[model samples]
Target: MTDREKIQQILQGISKTALPAQPSESLFDAGVLDSFSLVDLVAGIEQAFGIKIPDSDLNPRQFDSIEYIEKYLSSHR
Candidate 1:
């Protein structure tokens, strides 16, 4: 699967819900993710994408939505 698709699958596994309709939708605000799930999501991303997500860059804003995460990964990768 594509990276976005893989990310969605990972999110679904962590959140146990369908993904947001819009890429820019807030996963946290919408109850799709919480503090606990966010940690798992970050770790999941690191493992699934094989990219290092620095602890310093673990801002909630960066993980706010799929679009933001994709942008961050695209630029970094």
Candidate 2:
């Protein structure tokens, strides 16, 4: 799958467990994800995409939104 598709899948996985509504543009700001979910997300990205998430890449900006995660992974991958 393309990077965007992978990202959407990742978002879907998260939404399945934690998010009450479909991910909108403001889901991140709406407290849809917390620290525990952030850790789970990083693990999911690493395993799904076969990419190592380095300490340098571990920032809230990268994890805050699905769009940000897609951009970051697309550039790095």
lDDT for model 2, on a 0 to 1 scale?
A: 0.71
- Error (Å) of candidate 1 at residue 3 is 1.6
Task: Give me the candidate number with maximum TM-score.
Answer: 1
Question: For each candidate, C-alpha RMSD in Å?
Answer: 0.9, 3.0
TM-score of model 2 vs. true structure: 0.73
Cα lDDT tens digits, model 1, 1-77, are 98789889889898867788999999987788998999999999999989888889999889889999899889888
Q: Give the TM-score of candidate 1.
A: 0.93
What candidate 1 gets wrong by more than 4 Å, as runs, is: none
Model 2 regions lying over 4 Å from their true place: 17-26
Quote the lDDT for 19 in model 2: 42
